[model samples]
Target: MQNLLSNLKITINEKLYVKDPETSELGRKILKNSIILIDEIGFESFTFKKLGEKIQSNESSIYRYFENKHKLLIYLSSWYWSWIEYNLVFATHNISDSLNKLCISIKIITQNIIDDKNTPHIDESILNRIIISDFSKTLLTKDVDTENKEGFFLVYKRVINRLIDMITEVNPKYPYAKSLASSIVQGALHQHYLKDHFKTITNLSDKDCLSDFYIHMIKKILS
Candidate 1:
């Protein structure tokens, strides 16, 4: 899988950036360091000036790629979902059984992420942490509806749609496939957050992985 992914480029919404960050050395540096910086200080406290300082570039140079930090956050979120969608497709494409395919999809979506050596410019493990912690901020805004119409959240929605198709395949009669699919994706992040900061309310721990809990819950709901 790593070998397969190494050759592919993860696509994000072109509208999210003023320039393609993967196209040039400085652009790639911006992406590479932005992830590290955001992971270190978080989105609220993160700024292009800080990223410029870290990258040893002028703040104006950062703006050449992104209009502002909010757009940059949306770019990162879009890239993360696109990567997940690629992994989902590659991992489940050859599976013949619906249940097994759905189970693997759930695992891929819910399991803790690790750095993929294939993508040297991006640390997916760190990006996953950002997604778990700050992804909702991208959507819980007054601009969400307008952005939704502009297709800003298309990749994320596509991931849920893939799961919805898989759920329907497993049980064609299930009427709440869309609701369940969205819940599994969003709830995985929520559960992970709770496990990290509010442990008393969540059952997930070292002994029980998030994937196992969701898999069990999904199977029960579908049955």
Candidate 2:
């Protein structure tokens, strides 16, 4: 499975970066280590200079790939959503039951990420950590409208649209499939954050219960 995953290539929006990071080794290192640094120190404190020092490359080299840290953040987010959409399809493609597929989808979204050996450069566990903590920052910026116009959010939209299709499959007449799909994806991540930092506010007291709660919530709503 890891080997198969290694072969997976996600096409991120060209507008997200100045150069294609996947095409060069230094670019890949920038991505691999940036995820680690951001996960360790948080995005607000992360900088291209810090990333350059970590990767042993000049700060200018980092800029050759991404214009700024925010672009890199969006790039990582896009890559992550693309991977999630891939796994979602892989996990649900053979299932005939819409509800079963939805459950599997929820499981994929809510479950803890395991580091895959096939993609040695990408530590998915760290990437997921970044997603939970920093994903909204990608859109919650003044340039978001400009970025959106450039198709920077396509990968994210693809993830939501895929889930929306599944929700529609389960309940064609459901009035808010898109809303529910967005809620499940973003809410699951938010719950994970709440469980970690504000345990008293969330019913998800532990990681193991996250999948069950979301699965149950989605099922109850769809039923």
Candidate 3:
């Protein structure tokens, strides 16, 4: 973990992608493994030995990147924030209108149309994985007992706030008085994703229901 963190700092400051490929590879593996580890096994059951076995690396190597389970989760959550930000970078700068930009970006990030011909829709298991190891909630609030000195939380907030800021900037008339609204929107979205049933209904198996509902909701919020 020490070497990986050092490599990250150096890479950031020095702008050298050529350095620390091993550390970089390890980081990628950790991120991928973390998705499965957290979502499938849950946090309590996840272990470095299992992670190492899954990734075909030594337990010591996994330990070298993450000191403990909490650190490992934080690392994965932080990387997830970065991943989403990186994914949306092009969308942020692509359109001139913040409304369109936000709409497009949200579609990309919280994609509807699970059976869409274009994206092939997100896998049910993968969606479960994400919800279980949620990137959004962890970024905003800490579940751990200790105060989060690590500003990885900031990185997560930046993306969410950027979206909200874009919304606020584009729609001056829209009332967004409550800071809690952001969390509300995120929580609503998560509930829609995690639950198998649509609200009180159990027979409705259509996957696009929530996606459509979210689109309508976003449109209502933006308009």
Best by lDDT: 1
Per-candidate Cα lDDT values, in order, are 0.93, 0.88, 0.53
Q: What TM-score would every model get versus the actual structure?
A: 0.98, 0.95, 0.66
Pitting candidate 1 against candidate 2, the one with the higher lDDT is: 1
lDDT per residue for candidate 1 within 127-203, as digits (tens), equals 99999999999999999999999889999999999999999999999999999999999999999999889988888
Q: Which rank order by lDDT, best down to worst?
A: 1, 2, 3
For residues 61-101, what per-residue lDDT tens digits would candidate 2 score against the true structure?
99899998888999999988888888888878789999999
- Name the TM-score of candidate 2: 0.95
Tens digits of lDDT, candidate 3, 162-215: 767767776766777135335534654565545544545521244545435545
| Cα TM-score of candidate 3 | 0.66
Off-target runs (Cα >4 Å) in candidate 1 are none
Arrange candidates, best TM-score first.
1, 2, 3
Better of 2 and 3 by lDDT: 2
Local error of candidate 3 at residue 1 (angstroms): 32
Give the worst 10-residue stretch by lDDT in candidate 3. 9-18
